[model samples]
Target: MKAKSESLTAKQTIFYLLLSILLNSSGNGLTVSLNMGSALWTASSVNLSHLLNFDLKPLLVIYGVIVVITNTLLLGRIEPRRIINNFLFMVPFGYLVGWTSQLFNLLPLNQLSTPLKMLLDCFGILMVSAACSIYQRVNILLHPNDDFMQIIRFKFFHGNSTVAMWVSFVPPIIVSIICIIISRQIYAINVGTAFSLLFQGSLIGLADKIIFPSLKHHGVEQAVN
Candidate 1:
C-alpha cells in the first residue's frame, strides 16, 4: 500500500511539473508570436527606406532568447502547478485585453477620447496584474537582469515582496516612458502603435502578475487539499 501510494504521488507530481513546462512554453510562444506580428505590422506601415533603417529583428531575437533562458531557470526550481494553471487562465485573458486595446479606436471611439483612454487604463491594469501573477509563479529565472534588481531590492533595501517588485519595475517603467515619448514624437506613433505598446505591456503584466501568483496559490491550495 505504501509503495503504491508513493508511486501515485510521484506520478501526480511529475504530471503537474510537465503541465507547467508545457504551459509556459506554449504561452510564451503565443505571446512572442503576437508581439512579433504586431511589430512586423508596424514595420509594414512605414516607407521601405524607413523600414530598412529601423532594426527590430535584433531586439526581437534578444527578447526571445531571454524568454527561453528565464523559463528554463524558473522551471528548474519550481513545479508546473506553480505556473501552468494560472497561465492557462491569464494567457488568453492578456491576449483579449491586448486585442481590445488594439481595437478600441476602431469601435467608434473618437481618437483616444477620455472614455476610451480610461477603458484602456482599466484594461491595462488587468493586463499588468495578469503578468505579475505569471511571474510570481515562476521561481528564480528572470529576463533582462530583472532578477538582479530583485536581488538588490532584497539585499540593500530589505524590502517586502511588493516593494521589491515595485523597485524592480521602476527602471523598466522609466525606459518605457521614454520609448513611448520617442515613438510618439519621432515615429509619429498612431493609434495602432499606441495600442500595440499597451498590448505588449499588458502581455508582460499578465505573465508577471496575474498568472504567476494565481498558479502559486493554486498549487498551494492543491497541496493543502
Candidate 2:
C-alpha cells in the first residue's frame, strides 16, 4: 500500500535516467560475461546473433530498432520525441554493455565455483531490477524493451508491473523459439532467464517500495502516446 506517485522534476528525471542506465548496463554486462544466462530479450538477441553469425553489438542495436517498431505499433501513434528518446537510450546502453562485458571478460569468471557464479548472476539481476525501478519511475528516456514493459504496465494491465513484465516477455519468447527452430540450438537462456521470468517484475515492484519509496512514475502519458 504505497502512496500515490508524484511527478519527477527535470533534474530528478535526468539523474535517475543516467543512474539507471549505468546500473542496467553493468548488470547486463555481468550476465553477458558470466554466460550463466540473460534476460529473455537479451537472450533472444544472442540466439539471433548465433543463428545469423552476426556481430552481437550491432545485432543488439538492430534488435532494439525492431522493438521500437513493435512499441510504435502498440502505441498506435508515431511520436518522434518518444522514438528519439528510445534510440538515445539504445546507443549508449549498447556501448556500455559491450565495454563492461569486455572488461569483465578479462577476469576468471569461468574458474569461479558454480554457487559463486550463481550468486553473481543473481546480483546482476538485482542491479537490473533496481535500475528498472528507477528509470521506469523517471520515465524520461528508456530502453525500448523497458518502454514496452512500461506501456503494458500502465496501459493494459493497470499498473501491474508483474503482469506487464510477463506479458512483455511474449515477444522475446517467440524470437527465441524461432531461433531454436532455425538453428536447433539455444543461446543465453538458462538459470538467469528463469530467474528473470519468475522474479524480475516482482523484484522491480519491490524496489519501488524499498529503494526510493518517494520516487514515482513520471510522464506516464508519454508511454501510451
Candidate 3:
C-alpha cells in the first residue's frame, strides 16, 4: 500500500506538470496572437529564431539544452532521467503551442482596440503566472528554465523566489534589446514585455497564497503523500 501510494502520487505529479505545461503554452499562444511581447525568455527565443532563420521549435529545443546544462552546472549534478522526461514533455508542449497559436490567430484579437489588447495581455500574464505557481506547488520535475531560476534563488538569492524570477528576466531582456537594435525593429520587446517584467512575480506570489493553498486542500497534498 505504501508503494502503491507513492506510485499514485508520482502519476498525479506528472499530470499536474503536463497541465502546467499546457497552460503555459496556451498563454504563450495568446501572447503571440496579441502581437505583444512574451515573457523574457520566450521573447528572446523568438528573436533568436528570426535572426537565425530557424523554426521556433528547433530553437526552443536548443535553448532547452542550454538551460539544462546551466541547471546541471548550478546544481552540480545531473539528473538524467528528469532531464530526459522534461525533453519528452516539451515535444508535446511544442505541438500544443503550435495548435494554440493557430487557434488564437483565427480569432479577432488583432482587430481589438488598444485597451482591449492590453487587457488580453494581462490575461495572458495571469495564465502564465498561475501555471508557474501550479508547477512549483506540485514540487515534482521542473522544466529546465524554471529549474534554473529556482536553483539561482536557493543558491544565491537566499531563497527569494520572486526576486530570482525577476532577475532571471534581465539576461533575456538584454538579448531582446540587442536583437531590436541590430534589426532596427522592436520585434519582441514591447509593452507586454514590460508588464510581464513588472507584474509577473507578484502575480505568481498571489497564486501561491491563494491558488496553491486551495489546491493543497483539494487532494493535491493527498496525491503527494
Candidate 4:
C-alpha cells in the first residue's frame, strides 16, 4: 500500500512539472520572436547589429568539445532515452540561445548600462532555466552538454551529497577565460551569460528533483537503483 501511494504521488508530480515546462518553453519562444521583430523594425535606426558579427568560434569549439567528450564517456552507461531527450531540448534551445544572444547584443542599449543589463539578463536566464526544466520532464535523454557532470555527481559523488549544478560550469568557466584572453568580444563571458547558464543548470535540476522522483515511483528507478 505504501509503495503504491508513492508511485501515484510521483506520477502526479511529473504531470504538473511537464505542463509547466511546456508553458515556459512557449513563453521563451514568443519572447525571442517578439524581440526579433523589434530588432527588424528598428534596424535602420540603430547600428548595434555590428555586435552580431562577433567571432565566437573559439568559444563554441571549446564548449562543443567538452559536451562531446562527456557524452562519449557516458555513452553506454546511461540510458539512450535520456540521451535522445537531451538532444531534442539542447539542439533547439542551443540554436535559439545563440540567436537570442546575438539579438540581445543588437538591442539598442548599452551593455554598460547596469540596470538594463540585469533586466535583459534575467529574461535570458529565465528562458534557459525554463527550457532545461521542460527537456528533463519529457522522458527524454539528458542533454549531452550536461551529461558528464551529472553522471559524475549521481554516479561517483552521490547526488545528494553534491548537486551537479555547481560543477556544471567548470568546463565552460575554463573555456570562458580562454575566450577572454584571445579576443575583445563583449559577450565572451559576462554576467548576463553567466546568469543564463546558472538558470540552465538550476532548472534541469528542478526537473530532476521533480520529475525523476515520479519516474522512480513508476518503476524507472529500477535501472538507476
Candidate 5:
C-alpha cells in the first residue's frame, strides 16, 4: 500500500509539473508580447545581452549556470541529481516559452489601452506565481531560478515564500543596475516588472493554498532520491 501510494504521488507530480510548465510558459509569452515589462531575471538577461553584446539564448544559459552554482552553494553540498534536473527543466521550458511567445504575439493584447495592458501584465505575473506554487510543491525538476527561490524559502527563510522571493531577486536587481550604468537605458523595466517585484511572492503563497490545496509539499529528500 505504501509503495502504491508513492507511485501514485509520483504520477501526480509529473502531471502537475507539465501543467505548471505550460502555465509558466504562457505567462512569459503574455508578458513578453505585451512589452510593458518582464520578470526581473528576464529583464536582467535582456540588459546583459545588450550590454555584453552576447546573443540572448547563450546569455540565458550562462545565467542559468550561475544560478545553478548559487543553488549548490545554498544547499551547502553538491547534489548532482538535483543540479542535472534543474538544467533538464530548461530544455522544455525554453522551447515552450519561445513557441508560446510567438503564439501570444498573434493576440490583440498589444492594441489594448495602457490601463488594460497593465492589468494583463499583472495577470501574467499571477499565472507565473500559480505555476511556481504548483511545481515547487511537486518538487521534482525545477528551473535554476525556481530552485534558488525554493532553497531560500525552505532553508533560510523558514518557509516564508515572500521573503525568499525578495532575497532571490537581489542578483537580478544588481545586474539590471549595472546594465543601466553602462548602457544608460533600461531593457525591460516597467510596470510589469514593478508588479512582479511587489506581489509575485505573495501571489505564489496564495496560490499554494488555493490552487491545489491537497498537494502538500513533497519531502526534499524523497524528491532528489
Candidate 6:
C-alpha cells in the first residue's frame, strides 16, 4: 500500500528502535531513581524484580519472552522472523534499561523534595508516552508486549483497540496488588503509576493526532507539487 522508499531502511529502522529503547529506559530510570511507579506493565516488572532480587534487565527479558510465548500460543503458530527480530530488539533495550538506571542514579534526585520528585515522575511518564508514540509511528517490529496487546484486541475484543487496551491492564494491576500483599509494602505502585494508567492512553492518542497528520500533510504537499 505504500512505496518502498516510504519504508525505513534497515539502518533507519535500527536507529528508531534504539532511540525508542533509550527514551523508554531513561523514563524507567527516572521513575526508579525517584522511587515512583510507572505504567502497569512496568510496575509489575519492577515488583517482580524487587521481589526476586533480580536486576531489571533480566526481568524485562523474561517478561518479553513470556509475552512472545503467549502470543505464539494464542496465534497457533510461531513466526520465526518476527520472533527473532523482537528478540534482537529486546537485547539492546534491556541493556539500555540497565545503563540508564545507572545514569539516573548519578543524579541528585534523591535529595529533591516530595513535590519535585512527583514532578519528575510526571516528566518521566511523558517521556515514556512519547517514546511509545514514536515507536508506533515507526511501524517496524513491535515489542512483544505491544504485539500481544494488538493480538488480544483483534482476536478477542472484536478489534476494539480501546477496550482491549484497558482490559490488558487488568492482569498487570492484579499482579501489582499481589506483589504488594506479599511484600507487605507498596513497592513501586505509587501516585505516578495511577497517573500513567489513567492518562497514558490519552497522551498517546494526542501524540498520534499531532504526528500522523503532519506527516500526511507533508506527503500531500509533496504529491501536489
lDDT of each: 0.36, 0.86, 0.71, 0.43, 0.81, 0.70
Model 6, 1-225: lDDT tens digits are: 122236556786677667767777788778876777777788888887887789888788888898888878877787787688678767677667667877888988789988888988888888777676666556455677766665665467654445656776787888888887888766667878988887776665566566543321112112111
RMSD of each: 11.0, 2.0, 5.1, 8.5, 3.4, 5.7
For model 2, what is the alpha-carbon lDDT of residue 45? 84
lDDT of candidate 5? 0.81
Looking at model 6, which ten-residue stretch has the lowest summed lDDT? 216-225
User: How would you encode candidate 2's per-residue C-alpha lDDT over 1-225 as one tens digit per residue?
Assistant: 223566666787788888899999899889888888888888888789899999778788888999999989999898899899999999878778878888889999989998898778878888999999998887778899999998888888878889999999999999999999999997778788899999999999999889878887777865575
Between prediction 2 and prediction 4, the one with superior TM-score is 2
**TM-score against truth, every candidate:** 0.36, 0.93, 0.85, 0.54, 0.90, 0.83
- Model 3, C-alpha of 11: deviation from truth (Å): 5.7
Task: Give the lDDT of residue 197 in candidate 4.
Answer: 47
Q: Say which prediction, candidate 1 or candidate 2, comes out ahead on TM-score.
A: 2
Which clashing pairs does model 3 show?
A: none
Q: What alpha-carbon RMSD in Å does predicted model 2 have with respect to the real structure? A: 2.0
The positional error of residue 200 in candidate 3, measured at the CA in angstroms, is 1.4
Q: Count clashing residue pairs in model 4.
A: 5
lDDT of 4 by residue, 41-80 (tens): 0111111222434333233333444575565565446555
Span of ten consecutive residues with least summed lDDT in model 1: 1-10
Error of 2 at 131 (Å): 0.8
After aligning candidate 2 to the native by TM-score, how far in Å is the CA of 110 from where it should be?
0.8
Per residue, candidate 5 scores C-alpha lDDT tens digits across 116-150 of 99988878888889998898887778889988888
Model 2 weakest lDDT span, ten residues long: 1-10
The residue-level lDDT of candidate 1 at 93 comes to: 35
User: Which digits, one per residue and each the tens of the lDDT, describe model 3 over residues 40-100?
Assistant: 7778877877777787766777777788787777667776776886687556665666577
Candidate 2 error regions (>4 Å): 1-10
Kindly report which residue pairs in candidate 6 clash with one another: none
Runs of candidate 3 with Cα error greater than 4 angstroms are: 1-11, 214-225
